[model samples]
Target: MHSPSVSHRNAVDQILRYLKSAPGKGLTFSKNRDLEVVGYTNADWAGSVTVRRSTSGYFTFVGGFKPEKPMELHCDNKSAIDIAHNPVQHDRTKHVEVDRHFIKEKLEKKISRLLFVKSEDQLTDILTKAVCGRVFYDSLTKLGIGDIYAPT
Candidate 1:
């Protein structure tokens, strides 16, 4: 089961609301906190029928504990992974020629790097599909969302 989340629906709106609603410029001085980044991503196996590309995205934030990029995406690619991964290219990859060339160039420039992640920990799936209600909530909750309460 998947639980509904306001954060997944409108990302831009979520960022704006977070910036506007957050208490202040974030506690840094006396809190003795260090800014850290946590990244996560997920991929759908051959999600696109038109090109047989996988839909995927990666995002980084301060682990919902500190202020950082808020909710900015580092990469959202449906057909670019093949370009990033050199070994994946074979006979079948010739179909998405243009995208392949472009993303390959980007990959060479250090613009992106591909990494493998397990399905059970693929947090991005919650946003990509209409999952069972409870399953969604459980995933998001485990990601330290909608449950963290900082005490004053």
Candidate 2:
């Protein structure tokens, strides 16, 4: 923003081109045999070398006909999960004071349960990191997105 460069312009152009090519691409929801709301969260710790800030994201699924239980939220970062469940504060977690307390309160009320998930299985990875072609497609499938025009 301070100094827009040629690369930044090119990146914007590339995104525009992609959007033009896939104008119809989007998510579609349908009735299924199971009905449950599951959430997945992931964080890329220190992903940005410039600022050493982490990137995190979460996605939720609703309705499939199956019986539902208390919502379960899967997080790949054990530290963040621990912070959400732990009532004590520490120097290292001072940066996330607000989020810590909010998530802790939710957990205490049994509104949701936090569970650990391996990085590879974390679907939110697609939003926070650059993944391979296969992985990207897998993430799309997990998110219930697919090429509707493709032959079955």
Candidate 3:
């Protein structure tokens, strides 16, 4: 921010516009019959061309009254999912060995189960990606976010 560029200013203005358009939109939790926790994880492998870094994200949903069962975690990256389950370390995944071991430990203790999910169905995309129009609205609905002023 030492020397702001035109692109940065435009991006900020766009965000402000979106915030103004959905000032009352927010998450609305409701009670349900089933008491369970579901989680979703996704990673954009080598998403940044400049730094060649991957972006990973996850979300957990606590349903009903209490924790009924081990949380179900859905992941879109097969390699990351495999790393979490496999105890043997490999050269490619050595950098993330700590994270792999942590998730593996959780799996062994039955704290959570890692499951595969299609990229299109991953609800956390809204938070991690710059999506708009139908895709954006769809993700918001799946995340239980709605406009308070809109009629049900």
Candidate 4:
């Protein structure tokens, strides 16, 4: 934030453009009786050509209002889901041991349950990737975002 660059400027411009395009679009969290919390998480491992670093994103929503029961976390990566469920450690999984253990702890405490979701159904993809137009709008609709100015 202290030092700005051309890339950062361009990114900001893009965000502004999106906001301008959807001036009345907003998310609606309706009152519900169910208290089960649902979440989606996705990671793009070593996706950047220059940095070779992973980009992780998650979308969590409380339908019932509170997490009275185990929070359902949907993920697209089978390996990550397996590692979170498995206790036996291997060198190959050491890189993500910290994250894995955190999730494992949550699973043990019944605070969260990690489950597999198809890539197409993973809502977090909109945050981590440049998806097709259909996917973009579909995800927004799923997330309860709507354009208030649209004709009824």
Candidate 5:
């Protein structure tokens, strides 16, 4: 690296703080017969204070060894869900990137189904937003994450 600034140091500090705050956190999986796969996706549209660029993320969970049936994808943005379901492209959808059309293809093939979810219930928020502690822990719990080192 040629040069490092205060911003980099601050970022490292923030990461260290997060690690220290949750040292024992881990994911646990057990034997299960149902192999249902569910995914949650969200985008912070122009949520950045400095650059105003949208950032998106997704999280998926598989209950067993093999995924069964059509994968359920939950999204908080209704417009995105609509676009994914609509077969006919409109003028407004012209600006959407080419890669996004993959979702439409998947939908048409019955590989996945897109569903609308409320913002508060969007489990992907923990990955994309600086949510409060309550929301963060709740999301983690919903995702089957637990503290492995906790006393029994």
Candidate 6:
């Protein structure tokens, strides 16, 4: 969700800088880690003013996987959940519907339950993958991204 003229490469570089500058800085998966994935997923749902397409994003975990099982995705969209739950062939969602299959199957196999998270609570915002320095640093701290940045 950025400017139309912004090239993907530039975006990738920006994200890379934030990640690399703070080298060895990341959320590590360790036995002492007590936190769950606490993931968030979101889509603009017809967000493209030009194409009417949506962009979706979600984060997987603290360690990135839970017990070798997929993380249960929480979402605020009932319609998306409906589309995901049914998995029937439909026109409106057909374009971006492929991602829903995993969740649908997860539900059927009792592997996941789509919990509803309020928009404000979703942490997906911090993960634009490209952001300004201050914004990047703010998100970094918010996600507990640094012992590296902590004052010495």
Worst 10 residues of 2 by lDDT: 62-71
- Runs of candidate 2 with Cα error greater than 4 angstroms are 1-12, 33-35, 50-52, 64-68
For candidate 1, the 10 contiguous residues with the lowest summed lDDT are 69-78
Count clashes in each candidate, considering only residues at least 3 apart in sequence or on different chains: 9, 8, 0, 2, 0, 0
**What are the per-residue Cα lDDT tens digits for candidate 6 across 1-152?**
46445566787888699667767587633465443445667766576566776677787656544544545677777777777777476877677665667667778886666778776555565542334567656655656666655577
Q: Could you tell me every candidate's TM-score relative to the true structure? A: 0.42, 0.78, 0.81, 0.90, 0.84, 0.59
Q: Which candidate has the top score in TM-score?
A: 4
Model 2 deviation from native, Cα RMSD in Å: 3.4
lDDT of 3 by residue, 45-108 (tens): 7875656867677888888655778789987778778888877888898788788888888899
Model 3 misplaced stretches (Cα beyond 4 Å): 1-12, 64-66
**Candidate 3 lDDT score relative to the true structure:** 0.82
| Candidate rank order under TM-score | 4, 5, 3, 2, 6, 1
What's the lDDT for residue 32 in model 6?
Answer: 55
Q: Return the candidate ranking by lDDT, descending.
A: 4, 5, 3, 2, 6, 1
Model 6 C-alpha lDDT versus the unseen true structure: 0.65
Q: For model 2, what is the error of residue 46's alpha carbon versus the real structure, in angstroms, after optimal superposition?
A: 3.5
Q: After superposition, how far is residue 99 of candidate 5 from its true place, in Å?
A: 3.2
lDDT for every model? 0.56, 0.81, 0.82, 0.87, 0.83, 0.65
Off by over 4 Å in 4: 1-4, 64-66
Per-residue lDDT of 1-152 in model 2, one digit per residue for the tens? 57877876996998799778766667888766775678998878889676696887889887764436667899888877878878779989888898888888878887778999998899999878889989988988888787756667
The lDDT of model 4 is 0.87
The model with the greatest lDDT is 4
